[model samples]
Target chain A: MGQRPGDLSAPARLAGPDEGIGADELALATRNHGLPLEALRHDVTPPGLHYVLTHYDIPYVPDAGAWRLTVDGHVRTPLDLSLADLLSFPQVTTRVTLECAGNGRALLTPRPVSQPWLVEAVGTADWTGVPLRRLLAEAGADPAAVDVVFTGADHGVERGVEQDYQRALPLSVATGDDPQVLVATAMNGAPLPPQHGRPLRLIVPGWYGMAQVKWLRSVTVGDVPFTGFQQSVAYRIRRTPDEEGEPVTRIAPRALLVPPGFPDFMSRTRVVRPGPVRLSGRAWSGQAPVSSVEVSTDGGAHWEPAVLDPVVDGHRWAWRAWHHTWTATPGEHAVGTRASDADGHVQPLDQHWNRGGLANNAVCFVRVVCVADACWP
Target chain B: MGQRPGDLSAPARLAGPDEGIGADELALATRNHGLPLEALRHDVTPPGLHYVLTHYDIPYVPDAGAWRLTVDGHVRTPLDLSLADLLSFPQVTTRVTLECAGNGRALLTPRPVSQPWLVEAVGTADWTGVPLRRLLAEAGADPAAVDVVFTGADHGVERGVEQDYQRALPLSVATGDDPQVLVATAMNGAPLPPQHGRPLRLIVPGWYGMAQVKWLRSVTVGDVPFTGFQQSVAYRIRRTPDEEGEPVTRIAPRALLVPPGFPDFMSRTRVVRPGPVRLSGRAWSGQAPVSSVEVSTDGGAHWEPAVLDPVVDGHRWAWRAWHHTWTATPGEHAVGTRASDADGHVQPLDQHWNRGGLANNAVCFVRVVCVADACWP
Candidate 1:
């Protein structure tokens, strides 16, 4: 409320490093949402159940069929493609997992003051789209292009920088076949929902959600590394605001429990009857396929290996299911899970803090109580 | 971190009346979302854009095909129907606007420490299912039945009481022909999304969301009113902790603006250029159809009527679109909107206080700036 309209370059209000979440952060949290742990029980997150984080308003695309995508910049032949034109191309559907780079930001001490995600910012979806390489090949990208900048229709100001939502991928990643990048037009066999970027969006497999630009409108074959605000200013893992830190990409290995039993309405703390309870959850990694998962019934003091579901044929980029059977006693306990990928990147037992709190894939912990049978409904 | 699991009756941590939102409240906000103001532009909110608030975890129905709805208790003929059986009945679709009883709870002074909703907890959807009266008629309700209790598969503890999520409607309301209630199986044009009660749910038009139980499992006809925890403890308009107050029901007449321009990332404040701007939004009421919507650009000092879209042949329960054109000069302004219903219910200029913060339909206010053209994006 104290902001001056003329102060165009001023940073808006944020929660103090040591203070509780401010109204502004709560406002953002209410607008965007994190996946509920219970929803992890589903193999493919259903519509509306998937976690959503939009930096700007979901732009109103009055007529999606009329929307066009332009491929220009360093391309040898600039091309304009309509929805029907893109749909005519050979379509491929891939099951991929997407996670917010700031999944555990709020859990960090001196928490980064945006979104406030807490380990629930991940979901798997079957995205159907035309391969980006096919589009780039048709447009004849210039050999010297270094990055493919994707621009979305959503526009807003972030960190005092006003611009359209844009993100860029290295040219090699965009054209590679290992994990195909796609210009997605459908999700889960249905036309894209408005919030998930209806009309068109980019789906960068194995990368953090920032690489998947929604409401995509323009794709530029750039000769230089794209240095937009989102590309450089935000989504960076830094120790301080002044230094330009590493750009955040790829989902870090993480496992989350499905939160066994029912949750208290206000606290969301789990209450289960003392018995042999099956603990299950999903684990995924963008850097590499998840190789193993470990479970701890008594916090991080001791750990045991959990059974990992065999990798499916075509879902190498989707999450792997894992489970552990625990004979719970009647008492309070902290349950935790950690996932490690084939690349040997293990979740840290404790959090490593960064200025932006990007990619804090620490061990996921859930506080629960195993109540006596008589007390449970 | 301070709670004792064994002390079942103790209230969980709550933010003091004057304190900022606690982490627990923020956690709730991230799990549930309010409809973004821009979404009002859609006549029928797309999948995932609709507001959702699940009291407990979204119950996992392993096989929705095998799920059954039982009508028992005082009914003349207890009936158990499968998903297929319910689908064979005559289906009716209704476009209804459902609002949480606690829509503007967060705006109240000494705010209620619950979901912390601020105006966005409302959405309009086309719900398709069989009418509840048809089912009741088939089951042959007892003549002396006074209430119809709905029980959902979701079970959880609240205020130390454990039970399945349940709510009841007076028999008259459930059987009345006006604004027929439906046992909805599809939302929009697709099967119910998980977060929106997959398999089946009850949709009572013109009532608050609590009466429309999701993940529905049973209906009980009773000679006495149902006294479940959700009915007696929560969702009440209590003046003091000990007072019963009135039972919360029906959406209050309210109007919200589709925030005109781009928003700042952290604060979500709007900024616009110095020129003519068209403003549009939606208004609705539960007690009666929305009759008028008024707009105020000078912080409620003066008001002007907005043009309301003509009512369609159907969709009597859906929201009415309203718009106003304003000539802007460079300065800060607080824009407000207020709606009145045909029943003579007008939204208050200031919020009314209550213990549970239920049914607070105060005027909606949005802060914005008509910045000089030079500073605009």
Candidate 2:
């Protein structure tokens, strides 16, 4: 059953430092998970290791063979395609990095009581699918259409508004050649896993994860801007409830290091050996390719340029690897990293706060204590 | 560097309701995740959707082909085998259900501040591998051995003690014919995923998740009991920290329903239509095959029998499906479910309190509100 607008829970509130995450928030965190920072070692994260944030129940699509994708609305000709029909189209594989808009939401001073994600809310995947432009061209799209809305089978209520989990993309981006969007059918050379949208899903390269509508069912072209609940209400950067905030779209530049050495089970404080250590991590941005990455051994107080790996062809949307070698001394220290995109967009030392805690691309710092080998068993 | 016994964090403490989950706890929850309750609909949960609780980082197993498994200690002949060696053995695949000892820990009165899992810390998977008995026999296992300690490559510090992650099983269980344990190399018919110990892992049927060691490296047959931190200190049932609590082993009898209807984003409250709703869920127990399941519609004030699906051969370790149909009227109601095993171990209505909060299998309740169709947008 659909939920009524009046059948709402308490309005979203920021939790103070002393305020514990409520049972409701804990429930969300338990089901949705972030990629462990150490998983950064893999160029293409295994499907199971990739981050996931499902807003609703993973719909049970028992028979994918019978699933169909419908394309209509503001089009010269409507088209209905089955899984087999979609498979018949020419396929393209793209390695793309997808990051949640609220990746560092948990680091905020008074954090938005939502997923409470840390820097781990990101992953790179090999997505294979039919380009949206090809599907739209075959369907005879109308040039007058301003936006295209994608709908997923998963449904739920958000802020008291019941929706079919719809999100709209500007027609330009939907049909553009630079960063082509796709009706993704496979991930990492295999059919999409259930949590990644088993039967079908939309893959918008370089865009934040929210734009990649999953468990896709239909595509609708519209003349006017499609202002659905997901597009107009949620995923926005607002300072106040009544403000018409800027929309959160592309991922901001960010760099996260694969924590060096072993971890303490409780505090996750890293313990390292005193010697030459090679610190490495991945950096990326949606606005442009990451051109430079900086390492800070004393947190953000000091910085040094790190060597960047050559960007490979056909993987511009994926993260670029960077590494630095540091001669360590035995003591407690903080290590940090940041990135700058080709467009000159740099990660801020401290993130700007917003009511919804969206697009937090702040520098990441890891606390480490270097000691002698004899300290352990 | 390994952590010293003196470099410890504060001892584990149970959190009162008002006290918030510590940042350390949130850090752990973000990296580890539980299975979504709705995923129970699938008989074999997809590997990606399966529950994962890694104590340390998912070690970078760069090349599974080059990985080796060593069987030594107390064996008549030490055996060093490569991945190909393990794969060449007689292969066996079994569907087994695994539940965490801390499944319902968060629901306790004063909860242990760990992963904070609710009722979702469980999943079933088809594990393919070589039988442990076959491997032990090939290595010439010593019949006088009392325990078999399995070691994983992933290493970190727990309770200030630095060591490789390890767990031990009784000699009989390791080489038994009834509930065969496996040196699993694959999951769900494919090579084991990275998070699931890409190279190798141990799968002990009918035991709690703690007994399943991922990222396996070596096996040591020993005459003395294994006293690792994970085996003796953690995963125990105790009244106080000083008590030598009983070791947690098998899964308790429990049932969890696929929460019906749609969920509200903030509170996860369920909304349903006024009609006949087919309530369904999965139930299981490690002690024995699930013999019965019951459904309660009024906060568990009363319960009625639910039909159980017949168990299939070769998959006796998996959960059994159960279903019940409820004709509903428009109003708010609490729906609950409970299960009993063949050994007469029934899920408790209220779980008993403990220091570590392990093996709690209390009834699960989902609050749902029934409304008319017009109530939705």
Report DockQ per prediction, comma-separated. Answer: 0.55, 0.61
Off by over 4 Å in 2: A1-5, A374-377, B1-5
For candidate 2, the clash count comes to 3
Task: Report model 1's TM-score to 2 decimal places.
Answer: 0.97
- The CAPRI quality class of candidate 1 comes to medium
Which pairs of residues have clashing backbones in candidate 1? Answer: none
For TM-score, the strongest prediction is 2
* Model 2 residue A351 lDDT score: 76
Q: After superposition, how far is residue A353 of candidate 2 from its true place, in Å?
A: 0.8
* Top candidate (lDDT): 2
TM-score of chain A of 1: 0.96
lDDT of 1 by residue, B1-377 (tens): 22334354346333565587776777788898999889999999888889999988998887889999998888778989999999999999999999988888777787778888988999999999999989988899987799999999988878778789999998888888777999999999788988888989999988898988999999899999877888888888777788877888788898989998888777788877778889899999888999999999998999999999987666788998999998877877889899999999999998887888888888977878777755544
Q: Estimate, for each residue in B1-377, the C-alpha lDDT of model 2 and write its tens digit.
A: 45454564557888976777778888888888898889999999987788898888888988888898999999989999999999899999999999888888888888888878888988999999999999999999999999999999999887778889999998999999779999999999989888888889999888999999999999999999999989999988998989999999888889999999988877888878898999999999989989999999899899999999888774778999999999777778899999999999999998778888898999979989888877665
Clashing residue pairs in candidate 2 are A20-B20, A272-B1, A273-B1
